[model samples]
Target: MSPPSATLPAIAVAGLAKTYGDVQAVAGIDFTVSQGSVTALLGGNGAGKTTTIAMLLGLLKPSAGSITVLGTDMLHDRHAVLPRLNFSSPYVDLPHRLTVRQNLRVFAQLYDVPGPKQRIAQLAQKLDFTTLLDRPAGALSAGQKTRVALAKALINRPELLLLDEPTASLDPDTADWVRGLLEDYRAERGATILLASHNMAEVERLCDQVLMMKQGRIVDRGTPTELIERYGRDNLEEVFLDIARGRGKAAQPAQAETAA
Candidate 1:
């Protein structure tokens, strides 16, 4: 794949907002993610990270703002661009009774991937799930399921990948392996990835930038190192702790930098 160029934004959001009858789930926010970048969306529960992702995927309508992916308006013309994007998370599941290969075949057909069997074979090998291909999906362990979900996500070779808690239930070693796979895929495809995760080390290791949210709004954004330095913390978890506890009063660190 060619190197990503910045002539056009891969993702752009302006005045993005979403509200429910009496509750605000995502307040108006704006940000941009460059092509071939891995950006992290982070926050404590109820922070609106998932809601924001849902909006981008056309799963939720924005009550107020606008979102554009690959120059296509997500709110109004997602169909034109949907095929270029894909998502994965442990919370999502395949058919319980289907064998892993069968589940993948169904999804491959959904995406209309050419050579479905070959594609599945490629993914199974790359993800190290070849041994589990004929096993019932429901019989797999949490870590195995995570790998299957990842293989499904990549079957389309998406230009834009969204991962929400991709490694939530994984052991540390398994999580690291998953992260490595993601990195390899991104490097090979020059894909744009947006990840919402609580794994501080993973984010610091893989993401080029991080956006921190709280109560439906983006409160801070920067490189992991930048946030750690600004918060005078040893690592992202400490910085996250400060923000979660309301100790980081200046959540918008774009205006100024303070020692950790």
Candidate 2:
């Protein structure tokens, strides 16, 4: 009845709050991420973006409210939901002593992935890591490490992918390649991605919608085009500046940026 109430979103956060003593890291934020789309979280320093993501991944307990991922309530059924999600961050590291292939093997086993060898081979080929597989992870270049980290994230074919600064420290060419790869992955699998990034251009290119945060609160949200239009700017960077400068209301759909 009633169309079966529709399926739950890939991710749902309601009245979510988190506080560290006197510092309220996140306050009453709510949003939903539909299945098979990319959602970008944008924020300046100390905006609670990291804290919010930590909670979504079940790495931290929320001070209040609720979170659900893929129809499982995070607070009540985290163990059931965690296996369906995976995270990748350029700032984090795999074991330095392990070869790239070994590192992936470890995670594949942890996720109880079937056909681990075939899965690793497929991902290595798809992600251009065939040669690096045998190389020690710490010995690889920064860009190479990023690729390996991504490979680890995809090893299990997770339903929900969480990325924080995924392309950080990568050269423009390499970053573009990685973006293309992610786009292909999304198109192929219809997976949901929640990305936290400072690269506005990349965000505009990859994200269908965005949540903008400031000082631990979600200050605004919309599609890239919607926010740009609302802020009277040609791009997201200017819109970000406007919000940071306390001029969020001045953003109008008609204002456009001058070419540099």
Candidate 3:
């Protein structure tokens, strides 16, 4: 059966912009993620990917335009709905003195997650981190911490997950496991995921759709295959390179910025 028309997108943004004095960090860009879809946001170092995610999470107010999450205005109703979403990144760290279990418990409380202990136990087992649960977060290896961070992100059983280089710093084997775990979680829960990663292999392996951002705007978007074919490339990394280097016709001609 088709989804209900009134079923709100997991996320939606139109003409979103973020400015810091003279720096147009995120110029007007727009996109939507349907409920339960896994999408990748790809870009180079100075692309607007970080600013865009920050705006969507309500951490940074957009200078112009609007954002809707689960059908309501995020700018106005963020508190009412922010709990339904969560984010994970290797760059961020849990408190050094907190045990893995303690960290999970803290986030569970923040998210008002019911039966927090039981949820933590389940996540530890699922993520194969049961042995590390009682250890201080600072004691963990890079891969262990990555798994723990992912568990914390999942503690709320979020409807939407934002992952920023989730598998970063891990060895190839561990990264593969993390990717597989994410794939399973989304499959089992029908959750929406917004992934921001420079890992093209990971993107092609996990994302259903890809959006390429450059110089504060989205220049092109499509599935891995679509972009590969469009760019006449063998893989997503090649396509990403072509776009990042302005080598393809897909690059949109830069237009004058119009504040919303």
If scored against the real structure, what TM-score would every candidate get? Answer: 0.93, 0.92, 0.92
lDDT of each: 0.88, 0.86, 0.86
Please identify which of the two predictions, 1 or 2, would achieve the higher lDDT against the true structure.
1
Compare the candidates by TM-score and give the number of the best one: 1
Task: Choose 1 or 3, whichever is better by lDDT.
Answer: 1
Q: 50, model 2: CA deviation in Å?
A: 1.1
Worst 10 residues of 2 by lDDT: 251-260
> How high is the lDDT of residue 144 in model 1?
91
Those runs of model 3 whose alpha carbons end farther than 4 Å from true positions after fitting are: 1-6, 250-260
> How does candidate 3 score on lDDT?
0.86
Tens-digit lDDT track of model 1 for 68-107: 9988889788998878889996656999899999999999
Model 1 stretches with alpha carbons more than 4 Å out: 1-5, 248-260
When summed lDDT is taken over every stretch of 10 residues in candidate 3, the lowest stretch is 251-260
TM-score (C-alpha, index-matched) for candidate 2: 0.92
